[model samples]
Target: MIQYLWFDLGYTLVSTNREDVYQKVLERFDVFRNREEIAIAYHRADKLFMREYPGVLGKDSRAFFPWYIGTLNYFLRLSLPIEEVLEVQRDVARECPIQWKAFDGAKMTLRHLRSLGYRLGLISNWDESARAVLARNGLDEELDEIVISSEVGIEKPNPDIFRMALSQANVTASESLYIGDNYYDDVVGCQKVGMHCLLINAYGNRGVEELSYHPIITGIQDVAAYLGHPRVQLEINR
Candidate 1:
């Protein structure tokens, strides 16, 4: 029986409007691409980094963004200079510092799970800005505990962080379930601590299916159904 539920921040509970941002930046370079095209390209690039680079996304932005945008451009087949795009992206970031927004049904699902008697928490490999992002999106109050990498000086895939969350929640690993988008960080990290985990592959073909022994969900909204909560199903039907 799972009494506690934990989550990853990026691509799990919240995500940036990468497609919109990328589209706008591309337009400045006179490069034309639809939002769907940009989104697909970004998804491919993101999966490559998540699988190959592992913790690159959690690293310093100065290095990470250039590499990421370069890869995204490859997938998008864009010839625009990477540095120019980065400059534009920085401007966009400054104007909209909080780019993350809760995914559709994220807050509802989390609150619903809390109401269903599960302790909700967050274990994310993110900078100090994570708390502000959660609060801005109204997700902070729904979580009972939030353990971020920068704050604790520890990151995921290390058993210590998972242990920290368990200690804070006062629950054994067996009584908890962690859900996230990254397989290496979320699934493998949970395995190290003897905790069950679920992967969220919104695109459905991110190459994790072959590597993951655990269940994979499309989004946070599927948690109630996955956990066998009939009330959520009933509400959805009506």
Candidate 2:
């Protein structure tokens, strides 16, 4: 029944490891914080920032570096200026690659799904840089629709964003299967609007807790197959 496939860009389609990015930037910039301390501090600040502005922030946990640096300056007892914090943000954005490494099975999976005649689209809680990543990975040309939080002025877990994506894809919630890594944003959001949802739990992130929703996979390849592919061997025989 799935007419369209909505892929979440950050963790589901392309990848970005915040800890890896932070370490890369720190080393590249000659920043003093070691890996472990930097990792903890970054996570703490990120949690605080997300709690503050979930819609305004993004999937890149390190995107709040400017505000985090400014806040931490007051807490760490360092007399750093705002200009220095700005410098840090600029440095990170430039030095850190914001690299895009597509999931292992992504390319082949997309081709297989398209061959089955399923419409492909993207919905992401990301910024404009996502287009570059998609272009590099060849998704920009493949997807029929693309939506980003920054472009839409709303982040995930919000029904309005899902509505926007469905509108562009020319399909109702009932006809779409949206897949993403985050439970609340991906699963709960689309489910509220009557759209089917799947959690691409690449890290098996459900932990030990029981989930209210069932049917998840560790990769986009699973969703692609579920929606339309049904294995190339089956198609070849037909």
For candidate 1, lDDT tens digit of each residue in 90-190?
A: 78767555378888677878888999999999999998899999999899999999999999999999999999999998999999999998888999998
The best candidate by lDDT is 1
The C-alpha lDDT values of all candidates are 0.86, 0.69
Off by over 4 Å in 2: 17-98, 208-210, 228-238
Window of ten residues with lowest summed lDDT in model 2: 229-238
**TM-score for predicted model 1 compared with the true structure:** 0.91
* Candidate 1 residue pairs in backbone clash: none
TM-scores of all models? 0.91, 0.67
Backbone clash numbers for all candidates listed: 0, 0
